[model samples]
Structures are given as C-alpha cells and as structure tokens.
Target chain A: MEHKAYLDMELLRFTTAGSVDDGKSTLIGRLLFDTKSIFEDQMEAVKRSSEKKGIQHIDLSLLTDGLKDEREQGITIDVAYRYFATPKRKFIIADTPGHVQYIRNMVTGASTANLALILVDARNGLTEQTYRHSYIASLLQIKHVIVCINKMDLVDYSEERFDDIVRDYKDFAAKLDIHDIRFIPISALHGDNVVHRSEKMEWYDGPTLIYLLETIHIASDENHIDCRFAVQTVIRPHSEDYHDFRGYAGRILGGIFRKGDEVMILPSGFTSTIKAIQTFDGELEEAFAPLSVTIELNDDIDISRGDMIVRVNNKPEVTQDVDIMVCWLNNNPMQLGHKYILRHTTREVRAMVKEIVYKIDINTMQRQEGEKQFAARDIGRIRLRTTAPVFTDPYRVNKHTGSLILIDEVTNETVAAGMIV
Target chain B: MSHYYLNHLKELEAESIYVIREVFAQFQNPAILFSGGKDSIVLTHLARKAFFPAKIPFPLVHIDTGHNFPETMEYRDWLVDALGAKLIVGSVQDSIDKGRVREETGLNASRNVLQTTTLLDTIEQYKLDCCMGGARRDEEKARAKERFFSHRDEFGQWDPKNQRPELWHLFNGRKNMGEHFRVFPISNWTEMDVWQYILHDNIPLPQLYFAHERDVIERNGTLLAVSEFLNMRGDEIVHNKTVRFRTCGDLPITGAIESTASTLEEIIFEVAASRQTERGNRADDKRSETAMEDRKKQGYF
Candidate 1:
C-alpha cells in the first residue's frame, strides 16, 4: 500500500469480551498474525516463552497478556489494548477478560468502543457468557456488534450449526438496545473466515471478519444530531498577534456547529452567535463530534470550565437530581448517603446517593428491586442528588453528555460509572 | 460525500488535544515531561495546537541525565525559546551529588535508572499534580495496558495490578494531595503514524533522527554512541558508522541503528519496512521479560 493510503485509512476502535474457553485470544491472534502486525521479534519472544513452558503449540495469549502474573496464570486479569492495521483501516482492540468477576474490566473496555466483538464456542451456542457480553455492549450503547462463532473446526465446520447459533443469537439480541448486529463462523485456531474466506464454509455468503471490520459503517457512530460542546477551557492568547482573541476551546461532543449559528451558554443561559470556529489549522466553516476547536462568540458571555455551548433550540436538561444505571467499579461496596465526586461532561460536583432502585442481573437481564448494597462489578439503578444542577442528556440520546464517573471522596478512586437514564 | 469525519491523523490529533485540555482543566499544576526526543517534540507541537493562539499553560519538565547528545540540547533550547514556555530541568547529576540516588558501576551501567529519582523529586519539589508524557502504548508491552490518565501513588509508584478504570472521554483525574498523574496524549499513536505526521506537516526534528556519521561501538549486536558517559571496556573498539536513532534517551543506553535514510520521508520509509519495535534498540527494556513493569513499579518513565 502507498504511504498516502495510511493517511486516508479510517480508525476503528473495537472491544472484544470473551473467556479463554471461547478462543477469544486465538481470534485476536489470528487477526494480528494475518495482518502481519506481530513483528518477528515479538513472535520470537512468544515462541521462546512457549518453548520454556513446554507448550505444544505457540500460545497466542502471551502476546496480549503482557503482565507477568497474567502470563504465569495463563489468563487475562485486566484490560489490554492491542493495535493492528489493514490497508483499509487502523484498528485498536480493547481486549478484556470474560470472567464473571472481571465485569468492571469489560465495562472499561466497552466504554469507548465503536463496536463490540463477542466470541462463542460453536459447540455451545448462545451461553450465559454471550448474553453478558451482549448486554454490556447494549448498556454502553455500542452501535455495532459482531458475534463470531469460534472453534468451528471442532463442530466440523457445519453450516447448520453456524446458522443455528446465529438464529439463537439474533433471537436473544432482539431485546438488546443495539443495532447493526452481525455474525460470522470461523475457527480462530484454523484461520478460517477470520481474515481469509473459509473454503470449507462456502455455503455461507457473508463477508469475512476482517472485511466487516474494515467496511462497517462507523462514520455515524457519534451523536451528530444534538449540538453539544462542553467548554474545557477558555483560551485567551495574551500575545502580540492574538491580543484581542478570546476563544472557548473544547471538543465538540454531539452535532455539527457552524459559524454564525446561535448557541446558548449553560448555567448562565446567555446567547451568542459563533463568530468563527478556530483551530491550529485556521478557521473552519463547521465543527462536529470529536474535533477539538476554539469558538469565538459574537458577544461576550460568562463562560468557564464546566460550562457548555449548545444550540439554543436543542438543549440538554439542567437539573440536580439524576436517575442512573450505576456500575460499581471499586472494590468496596457503594456507600449510601456518602458524598462522592461526580465527574460529568466537563464538570465535577459532589453527589449524595438518594436511593437504590434495583440491581441488574447482567447475565439474565433480571431486575432485583429494593437492593441497596452493591459490591464490585455490580450494576444497578440508583438516584443521586448533586450539590449543584448538572447539564445532562439521557444516555440513549447522547453518550458524551450523559455518562459520568464517581470518585471516592477519601480514597480518590473512580468508584462507579453512571449512565443518566 | 464528506461526512464530517476526520481521517486517522486528524482523529489522533483531536484525541490528543482533548486529553491535554482535560489535564489543564482537571489539575491545578501540570507539566510536560520533555526528553528532547521526536515523540516529545510531537507532544510539544500538539500542546501548541491544543492551546493555539495562546502559549501552553504548563511547563515543560526535563529530567536531565547529563548524558544528552549535543544536538538534542540545542534543539531543546531552541524549541523552548520558540514556544515561549517555561523549561524546568531536574538534573540526575544533582540528585547524585545530593545522594538522593546512587550511581551504578559497570561497563553497561547507565544513569537511566537514576533519572527516575530525579524525576520524582522534581514532581515533589514543583508540587506537580500531573505530568503529561509522550509515551505511546505501542512502545512497550507494559505500556500497552496503561491508562490514558495513569495514576501514581504519593510515593510515585505505579501498581500494574490495580489501576483506575478509564472510560470514554471521561478520565478520572481525581487524586489525593501528593498524588499525580502521568498523562500520555499520544497513547494510541504508532511509530509509523508519528513519522507520517511529521512528514505531512513538515515538522522540524533534530539532525540525530536523520542519518549522520557518529563514533559508535558494537555491543550485543547493537550500536551505542561513543560518549564520555559510556563506560568503555578495555577491549572495546570504536568505529565511524552512518546511523540514526529510532529513540532518543540517555546517550549511554539508547542505541543507534545503522541507516542510510536521512530525511523525514526516508525515515518513514525505513520505519514502515523495519521489523523490530522502536524500543528494540533500548538496552533498558531488554533487561528482563517484565523490565518495563519493574521500572514502572519503581516510578521510572
């Protein structure tokens, strides 16, 4: 490929959640190996380790399980990110363990993923692991999901078996709040249909796994309908050239922002027209989600960090009490009535736990009501009272403005992640 | 059909800028850990773009090992002056002089490990709550698992086993009084992406990154620049070879690679065709399987 092609290539960030039994590591290994991403030295190191351990075949997990203990135990304990590229796109894999206890790790990996990859053993179709992974993907509002029926060689590469699993998965996923679900049958260990089209499964007509990864429609993954720009900081260049330049610098979280568009400043409720969208490259006609730019307003307004710039007609709710689906991320249980530091959009406020509505059985999707205690990795619905009114949209409407993380006041650890309901 | 979607480079640039802005808003005191390397140069450039029309809001902190190449020092000084930013140098030699850290003794001994002490001391002295670094996740295995906002204890130690979970763009920068964060704005960037961006933007880099004739010695199949900091063995031989450094660090431990490529374009070509990682030449990471993990646990950058 030409060097210029690298510039045009799209970047796809995806997360994979599955147990070692599901051949998850092998699938990842296949992706890297087929793409020739694993360098000779890295492969050599893995070979040496496998030889030292007297393994029959090279263990692909060693490439990803970077930590010493994780390699020694032959299992993944935390989230590990792996990178690879094809001619079409650059990929970042947020690989997480699928153990029931490591739900926190899986959630961390899922938070920023544009797509989720859930592996299933072909022999066992649509198990609890599949449901858990699918549910988390939906809860995190991941738009796309790819379910790979791995270890097809063990099931004799039977088209009937693959179709049956796909049918079962579709039936279960119909209840999920996700779209763009796809399925592919492959043997990760045998290198069938992962990067290469499986000749054995010629009965299947879908694209290969790598093809889907490269061509999937992710241009619309971010929220482009709600105009939300969280002002991170105000840039006042007290320099000779930019003496009069006072620009609000931030990353646009939602819809497109055009020059001369009427926008409102939150908390202050002041209105201003965008004078110019400034960047290091110069002025832009418009700005959209994920671009960090500076905005010069036609009128002066009281704006600072934690303040937001949104389209006047399309505004997020400004309120103090919030109902949320809380994921317990810390080792200690959630403390009721204790003040926690709530970090939203660009604002940080003190939060008091109001009440626990119900606990979610992640695997079964059952709601256990009136449960107040939440241990590590527990997901539940809760109400919180922020010391100050927070500007937020429901997570279903906009992931950027709705998501929050709670930090323990004393220990200073990020204890919980809350999705505004 | 333009979809308002950024390409890979623009996306990466936006991500880095977002992270930089977060550090500024979240922390009272933050600084960029500068090593005068190309990565740090890219970082400094990104900081400029991040706060554009204005100067960088944070100081550029350099843990000077006193073993830097002359070209790197010149570049460092010139860049600092150009940016009009504060440059704070924490000297490893000073730490050695003050007995805060002891120097090692051997033919392969380097001040690479000693610089960690000076770095932590600098953070403590400056009361820096956050130290933005240019370290990429693709550089090393230990770093591959590192969070964008990596948490360090009051002792300046990193616990690989237990770390805060970073989700979405919502980075938890909360920490206790003495604790600080090491933020990597370019954590997702690869070596190829860095070189490609430099080429596309015509960014200036040190001549060291390009091919040049330098005095070097071969040891264990890698070339080490001949400098006073290198503890030469009795039987060692020095030769003039055309080489360039893939990574710049303490002149003693950072190995130079034999290359005919001189310009940014040529370097990118070499990088795309090269098989080894960027750190394959660094002797520090080759020490053990988990050498980086061990160093990171003890607060090494």
Candidate 2:
C-alpha cells in the first residue's frame, strides 16, 4: 500500500460507454484493480461467482454487474458508478451499459462527466455503438473524449489496424461537434496501456490511458467567461444576534463571482454589489463554478429560491420559449401540449412541448423531420413554452444553466433530459 | 487558474452542504438519520456548516436497536447538545415491546433486521418526508447504483428499476402522498475519502474509533465486543484486546478490528492497508450474498 497527501488532489469524473463485449467493464475493473481500489473481499466474491458460472478465469465484468438481476442476466442493466484514485488524481467512473435504453443511460452517465471513454473492439473497428456513443458524447458537450481501441491482443497488437481505426474514427468525428479527441490502443484484459504502457505495442508512442487521465487539463472546462449563479435557497438566521442577515445560498453555475462585484438580481432587475462571499470556513474573496457559497448583497430585494444572480452587463438570456435537444426517458410518449414541470437551474416552470422539430437516428447521425410524439429513448429537438421566463445559456456554454429536466405531471417521473440549443 | 478551483475535499464538502440545504428546502419535514458512526457524524458536521450561525433545521433521527456502544450514545447526546440541534429517537426495543417487531432468539440473534419496521413506523408517525442518510455508494454493491435522491413508495419500499433518472445538478424530488425519499449527500465519497475528510476538517469522533483495550470474543474470524447485547454461546470466551470499530452499526452485530492505531492518522494508515470492506465484518451481511440488498429493498438504511 502507498500513501500520499490526498487532501489537495483533483477529482476527475469520466464516463465509459461500450457494447456488452467491448470490454468496457474489463477496462473499469482493470483500472480499479491496478489502482488498488478493489478490496480483497470484493475480488473474492467476484471470483466465487465467476467459478460458479464455470468461467475459466476471474471474470472482471462480474464485479461491475452490481444487481442480482444484472448478474443473473449476465449484462449491465443500468449505469453504475465506480471510484478509483492514483497519486495524482481521484477518478470517478460512470459505467453505463451500452444496450437496453442506451441513450437514457448514456445521458445519465454523460451528464456529469468531464471526459468520456468510448470503448471500441479492435477487431470490430467502429460499430454503430461507437458512432452512437460518440454522438451522445458530443451532444452532452463533454470536454474530452478518449476512444480506447481495446482488445489489441486479438489484433496481434498491430499498429496498422490501430491506425486504420483511429483514422476512421477521426473521419467520422469530423461530422460530430467534438473537440479534444485522443485514441489509445490497449488490451484491458491483459493490462496493457490501461494503467501501464504495454511493451507489446512499441510502435504506439502515445501516453497510456492513465497518463492522459492524470495530465489532462480540466481547469478550463468550466464556463469561466460568463458569470451565473442560480439561487437554491435563502439563508436567514432569525436569531436576535443576526437579525438583519439575509444570504443567498447556491452553487456557482458559471464564471467567477467575487466581492464588490456589481451584480443584478434576475427577473427582479434589482442591482446590488456583492457584500461578501460567505462559507462555513469563513469569508472567501471569490468563488467559481461548482463551488457552493452564500452571497450577501448590499440590498434586500425580497429574493427567494430560483433567482439568478449575475453580472449586470453579462447576463444569461431570460426567455419564455426555449429550443432544446431532448432525450425522452419515459415509456409514456411526451403528450402534446400537456403541462410538464420544467426544472432548470433550481427554477421550476410549467412547460409544454410545442413542436418536435426532428428526431435523430443516433447510429447514422441523421435527423428525420416531421417526427410525431417523443417516445422512450427518443433523441430529438423540441420547443418548450414555459409559463415563466427562465434565465439560461446554451448547453455548450455552462452546463448548470444550460440543461433542464422535464417531469411528467401525471406520473411525476423525470420524462426527459434537455439541453438548450 | 488553479487558485479559483477548489481542491477535491473542499469541493466534496461544498457539494454535500449544498445537498443538505436542498433537502431542507425541498421537503416539508426532513431529518438526518444519525447512527453515531463516522459517516453520519461527518454528515452532521457538514449540516452544521451548511446552516452555520444557525441551528440545523432538521432533527437528527437515530434508530436505536438498544444494542449500542455506551460511547456511541454518549457521543451522540453530546453532539446534539453541542450543536443545539433537535434529536428524535426511534427505538427497536419499544417496537419489540409493543409487538410491532419480533426479536430474534438464539446465538445469532440481532435486532439489525427488525430496525426496518421501526424506522418506517417512525417516519410515518412523525411524517418525515425526507431522511438524509450518510450512506456512500462505494461501501456496497447495490449502493453503487443508488440515486442521490432515492424514491421510496407509500409502503416504504424501494423500486430499484423504476428509479427516476438523475442528471446534472437538477434532482427530481417529486413524490405522491405517503411516499418519501432517502437522500444520500455523500454518495460519491469512498471510505478512504471519509477518513481523509474527517482528518482534514478536524471533525470530532467517538472514542470507540480509536484503539482501546476492551473485552471481546472472536467469532468466524471477526472480533465482537463483549457487551451485554452479544449472545455468547458455550465455546465462545471473552478476552480483553485492543480493538476499534471501523463502522458504528448496532453494537451487537457490528464487528471490530484489533488494532493499536489510536489517532485519526494512524487509523487512516491502517485503513489504507486494510484489504476487507468495512461492512465485511457485519454478521448481518455475512448471512448471505445479497443481505444488504435484501435489507435495502425492505427499506433498511
């Protein structure tokens, strides 16, 4: 066992999407195993289960198929989160099954990922799943995409095959809205180029998967250009000691917020300067995206929850109508003109779908016009008419302010995940 | 560029505090399920920070199986008073006395399974719509797929397949009458992360966590504290050993590790070197492969 000063380590969240035999689960298990994240008992349990199933070797995939049903079915049924850490960074892996409502599961995993690991079987080159996962990764605006061409052992560790696959993927990705694409060739089962560089593929001189994960610059991933704050709640100590204190509490959605910044209260159009950035550890001079803090204002504008605090000059658009790329998550098709609860950045609004512009064929990256109702696992473009104006930005700008979820009023289920166009 | 971004611990704390505040805002009656364990204690500390300069709005709910470590109860009460927060206790002994639950008999008997009925009853009777638990996903297999805002039915059952899809920072907390939610703010944290956070934040913990000489009996290679709650049989003898509990479940079935690590730093070092899962010691989990999942399906925390 090894030790390090883990207090100041950076956290990187990544998602892995692959078909059943693409070795996705093996990659995850290998990472956890090599990083010493897997405990002895867990390995023992998996080993026993694998032996019972008459497997020749320790089945790494058995470790991740968490549910009893998932194990019985020998497949991953939903997205399961796995954790591992190196000395440099702590990694959170959102492992999504590549089949069975793949779109919904991928979106759920991709929602919070800074990077996406799209696994491709070297023997199978690029399958429909590769294109689909790549497309969704692009749609979700993930900052980095690492296409791991797994099972290179089966391809005789041929550099030419890896080159062909990479070139084909590069050509296909040109059509998708993706940036910062890197390709790695390795065998997850053999522990090659996943945690350590493999000597077998000496021709491939790229950094190992672990090296890329550790060194990738993610500080610039946040939307630091525009300042946006969505108030989750208001804190009031009602005590006699701090009678007049009113602090707006929320997570910073985008950009940097500092003290003495001239800010405007959204919808209310009230202008005030930030009196202070309050936290339990004491006052901070500034806070940025993803950091939760309480902000004190110069004036009490009767602000409650769902309010936005932004710079007076740089403001998110306040709109009653939004164009969104919605992935329907419910079996019940989205009803036409039916009121659904639209929750975006802490604000809840009554919204109804007005039009389905087009539905996407994830495999071919083509859009079909004149689509009727949005059904389960359907990815498409739709227009939402909200009863109240929502302060928003494009999904590519700031994820917190850019994304929304629609809840079916009758079932009270999260029916769809939407991204602002 | 790096100065603006928070380190991982501070960021995790911030995220948890945000969730604590969200639970306060989203539910009419929310409570924290305090087990006097390190995880729950850390949760309480975060909640206090979430509403600093003001008392925690939600009452700390402890489900007592009557098989407790004396130090745990003492620490629980002391923490409640120190924070000036409300405490609500749901006792399994009371439930057993009232015939709501049957106490298991014989050597393997424990109130661990019966706590579910009392927990549900407490929730219903008190009308607690949301209960914040300090359960981390990395702790168990079934927990890895748990949602931060887990929906429970009117009958206090979880429908794993029908769980709502949680995306981004937006969580759907909508539910019908009689239904409630179990919110796990620290779902992303691992056990190592918890210890590191506790050490980094200088959070106070019960003395039982640090090594101390105590009477214990070894059963199936696990050390059990020799307390009044344990059902000792004929070949089992008690002896004093330096032991500390990694987790604070009910004292009867919760296993302890023999160690001389007396400080947080030492405990962390031991934890790093430990090969077994923390819950690997719990007799309830040792009963079957899917014991925890089965308990969870029946609304066990």
User: Which of the numbered candidates is closest to the native, going by highest TM-score?
Assistant: 2
- Candidate 2 wrongly placed segments (more than 4 Å): A1-4
lDDT of 1 by residue, B1-301 (tens): 2577889889999999999999998899999999999899999999999999898888999999998999999999999999889999999999999999899998889888898899999999999999999999888888998999999999999998899888888898888888889999999999888998898878899999999999999998789999888999889999999999999998999999999998877888788788888888799988888999989988987
- lDDT digits (tens) for residues B233-256 of candidate 2: 889988899999999898888889
Q: A286 in model 1: Cα distance from truth in Å?
A: 0.7
Docking class of 2: medium
- Evaluate candidate 1 and give its CAPRI docking class based on DockQ: medium
Candidate 1 local distance difference test against the native: 0.91
Candidate 2 A-chain TM-score: 0.98
lDDT of 2: 0.90
**In model 1 chain B, which range of ten residues has the least summed lDDT?**
B1-10
TM-scores for the candidates? 0.98, 0.99
lDDT of 1 at A415: 91
Q: Each model's DockQ?
A: 0.78, 0.75
Clashing pairs in 1: none
Instruction: Encode model 2's per-residue lDDT on A1-421: one tens digit a residue.
Output: 3444677788899999875588888888889998888999899989998889998889888888778888888888778898888888888899997874767888999999999999999998998888889988999999899999999999999999999999999999999888899999999999999988899999999999999999998978888779998888888999998798898988898989989999999999999999999988899898898888889999878888999999999999999999999999989987567789999998999998898899998888789998778889989899989999999999998898999999988778999999999
- Distance (Å) between predicted and true CA of A185, model 2? 0.8
lDDT at residue A399 of model 2 (Cα atoms): 90
